[model samples]
Target: MAEVRPAFDEAARTHPPLREASSARQDAHPRQIRDDDLAYGLERVLDGLAARLEA
Candidate 1:
């Protein structure tokens, strides 16, 4: 059986421009998961749970 490398490697080899475009997009919009954002989400979930429990 042939060795199967990662799909990403195959894609990178097949289409170099696609890799460059993806890298550019990542650089443009980096992941910014701030603590405040997580806290806000947790607060919303807790509020929802409290409402459900009270209902």
Candidate 2:
């Protein structure tokens, strides 16, 4: 919306640095995603489909 951009910009400028918002602790494990996680994810397609779909 035309009214949203300036409001977002104002809040963004006032927001804290990103690191302060997230992890400050040591991790025992690293994050990961399997290969099939996206090859067949929230939305998938048929090679011969006539239309697209959304979740």
Candidate 3:
């Protein structure tokens, strides 16, 4: 947990510029939530539930 912020900042600095997104992309998600973000979040939640059930 202590190293997470530094690691994230390092990755952000080192990563290459991303490709341009569409206008709808900007309008729909001003907060920078990309396409499929909901699906990805749902998958993560489901994984956590499965792990808890198994435990």
- How high is each candidate's TM-score? 0.41, 0.24, 0.39
Supply every candidate's count of residue pairs whose N, Cα or C atoms clash at under 3 angstroms: 0, 0, 0
Which candidate has the highest TM-score of all?
A: 1
Per-residue C-alpha lDDT of model 2 across residues 1-55, encoded as one tens digit per residue = 3465456456656565633332221121223233435555534555325254432
Model 1 whole-model lDDT (C-alpha atoms): 0.62
Lowest lDDT sum, 10 consecutive residues, model 1, at: 25-34
Candidate 1 deviant stretches above 4 angstroms: 1-33
- Candidate 3 lDDT, 1-55, residue by residue in tens: 3445456446656453521333224335434465477778999999999999999
* Decoy 2 TM-score against native: 0.24
Give the winner by TM-score: 1 or 2: 1
Model 2: worst 10 consecutive residues (lDDT sum)? 21-30
For lDDT, candidate 1 versus 2, the one ahead is 1
Please provide, for model 1 over 1-55, each residue's C-alpha lDDT reduced to its tens digit, 9 standing for 90 to 100.
0233256556677688977755554423233435545788999999999999999
**Ranking under lDDT, best-scoring first?**
1, 3, 2
